[model samples]
Target: MAEVHSRSSHRELRVQAGASDNVTANELFDIEEQRNRLSRMFCFDGMGGALLIEPSFPGCGMIDAGKGDLIYSNALYEIKAGDRLFRSVDVRQLITYSALNYVSKRFQIDSLGLFNPRVGVSATIPVDDLCAEISGKQSSDLFFDIVAAISSGDISR
Candidate 1:
């Protein structure tokens, strides 16, 4: 996978599969650690572009990558989810997000594993309504499009 880039900002964060150590749920239980890691990737991804990785904390504990104790950050990227995932249109949006960011892209009330699930299920739906459903909403629907695709196995990296 290519390294994430961000040019408009000074804080760049790019966590390649082997470039740097991956932060496990056990290691990122604390807010500071999660912030630091996310900040790094944020700066890296949004180097020239303007974007932010806001961690859904306090009450946004629905996407469980590890224990609900661990945190998840919602990323705003300029690229499409398929581009990020490095997959064809056969992949789903949430799955693409998971593959690209190395973070779980959640769906529904259940914590379905995005990276690799024991039982796979389609998780695609209209993003317009979902984007409207969230507070502090940002215009980053590419991820949603990818989710819509991946849920149906139609992703193109």
Candidate 2:
């Protein structure tokens, strides 16, 4: 999934993904080893829910059109293969995607989630709860503020 990382930051990943040796290739095999388990961890009820991989939502202001890791059922789960637990960047990524979806009205995103296969851990929170916990604002108000801020040229990048 394309999180908010710069191109240069993925140079090593590009090399790792394309590495010629067997050991390195096996070392970078996240999909082969982690996909099903991580999806399950994200509560991706293999049969019941709609599973969308790399979903793109309508952009707002400078956000542009962006694709998230995936959305299973109604929850948007940001999949991370990092060595540790959830990070701030992970939460920001979900919030940014949610804000984008907030304006897009693409689908009913009732919950937000973070999953790390590397740590075998996952966390999910309802949309309003996440917004309230982060900013003490309802999701609608928080999303409106973000759109207004970006549209008003408040952010440089």
Candidate 3:
């Protein structure tokens, strides 16, 4: 956390980039706290797996233009920074990216993860386990459905 004072010059270098104005000391402190939490996050630095930051999404070898935040070992992780915790869309977004990776065959994705440093929470689920919860459909089956839809032009990438 940073010290909040009456001085006009705030050293909020890490909180926001490119511009220093319009940011309060409390926000900088909060972001620092969140950053500290992220640093303590589970072994993303080689112990877990090979870490790739903002990797390109080679979708279906045709659908170009999408980038993943991070890939650790076999899991694709999406980092979110917000005050809310209970968002299914965040999970759904990961699933979509996972589907893209599956169809593209660029990387071996075996699991999916969501990490929110602001709330100091992290979770990951195996792809197989997640697919098991989806009524009688494996990850392959579900992901293939997306590919099929994309192939048939029923959906936009």
Candidate 4:
């Protein structure tokens, strides 16, 4: 079981897991606490400012992805609610968000970041580097191919 406290709503959310779970309820609660703390740390003003939390990006023709944890100025942040460092999947997701946000030209993200509040670890990379890394991946070509196929309405190869 985990009790999460929301600062914005001033309410508590309780979450419970099976007793056979590997993670304890206290750990879950701690993770949620860290997430809330991180959100508050970056948010400016009560409404809108430079920081936007959990902003969703509607899918274009190929992909629809969003709900980014935070966006400060030109930087987009993805929060990981765990004590461990950022994993490859976390980086990939942030990079994707950055790339999509940039392509959309609506947000123009300049950088991407992964933050883990539990261990106080954070990695920030420029959008260009992220794009390069993503491009270098072998799967990138396949991903683009899929997008192209979807756009052309020709999935059958």
Candidate 5:
């Protein structure tokens, strides 16, 4: 079993192309939803060592509008690994994943909450594994093997 780490449940926010009368065009506001894949999260392990996963995991995400305004955004998520909130295992995964997956692909991140002070990053792993590692029942070595296959020589960079 995976070790239980810190956990701080946060609300997921999604900004639509057009702003409503209640909210200003550039003003930040809070809204609630049960769950949205665009802003959903998954963990690799039990907060021990994990990464954050969203719709644009392998790409820097953006919300484009027909007008001149180009809305760029990324999901704000917090992971709880250990005593540290947002600066532990998940941090490396976020940096590694973002670098290897999105940055390597030339995806742009409008803003990041990985190590922001404003947001409380819970260092706990989510129940799901976006990579399907759990269901596959593959050991760590096997998982790395799969990663090796998927990444090939590109992962070295």
Candidate 6:
């Protein structure tokens, strides 16, 4: 179980679990605190409008997309807290978010990036290059299929 505590402008979510567990309660608490700290760091007022934390995208359901982690003025950032190396799936996710942003015309996604603070590594791809790569892989059809399924609400097949 988890207990949420709110004090002033700070919020903490504490999970209670045994020490022997694979992920102990203290670990969960630490993770939540780190996330909150990162959120604060990327917050608009704190970052001088450089980044917006967890900005919502309207009509994301049309493409089965979710809110992105952070949004820079000209790009979208997906933060991976763990030390895991960046993968193709991560690139695909950012590309999909870029595509959705393009279609929505809310924010023109100039670039996409994967940031891993744990390892202090980052990779960025220009939206045009990403789109070209997806096209070269012939994956655009699959992406469109997903959008079609979501729009029709008949993903079952």
Pick the TM-score winner: 2
Candidates' lDDT values, in order?
0.32, 0.75, 0.70, 0.62, 0.34, 0.61
Off by over 4 Å in 3: 1-21, 42-48, 60-64
Residues 11-120 of candidate 3: C-alpha lDDT, one tens digit per residue: 23365643578767787788788877655553434354455667677656335558878776678888988787847888777777877888668778888889988887
Candidate 4 residues 1-157, lDDT tens each? 2222233443334545673488888878775777566655554335433655576665545556656776766677887866577788987677565445544555657777887777766778876666567675433453454355545655543
TM-score of 4: 0.59
* lDDT, candidate 4, at 16: 59
Q: Which candidate comes out best when scored by lDDT?
A: 2
Task: Tell me the tens digit of each residue's lDDT in model 1 across 54-111.
Answer: 2221211233232221111232222222212323333333333333333244322212
Question: lDDT of candidate 3 vs native?
Answer: 0.70
> Model 5 off-target regions past 4 Å?
1-53, 56-76, 79-84, 103-106, 115-157
Model 6 spans with C-alpha error above 4 angstroms: 1-49, 60-65, 137-154
Summing lDDT over every window of 10 consecutive residues in candidate 1, give the lowest-scoring window. 110-119
Candidate 2: deviation at residue 12, Å?
27
Tens-digit lDDT string for candidate 6 (14-126)? 55566346996667776766665554544422434455557556554546546887766566888887758888888877767665665577665677788775555677777
At residue 74, candidate 4 shows an lDDT of 64
How would the candidate models be sorted by lDDT, starting from the highest?
2, 3, 4, 6, 5, 1
Clashes of 2: 0
Q: Name the runs in model 1 displaced over 4 angstroms.
A: 1-29, 44-46, 52-91, 95-157
Query: Which pairs in model 6 have colliding backbones?
Result: none
TM-score of each: 0.21, 0.77, 0.75, 0.59, 0.26, 0.58
Better of 4 and 6 by TM-score: 4
lDDT per residue as tens, model 2, 1-157: 4333222222221334554555565566664457556545533443456566688877888888888887766889888888888889889888888888888798789999988776678898999999999999999999998888878886889
Model 4: weakest 10-residue lDDT segment is 1-10
In the range 1-157, model 5's lDDT, one tens digit per residue, is: 1122222333345666465666764343323222232233332223322223332433222211111101113322433323344444554454334333333433343333343222423222222232333345323343344445445544432
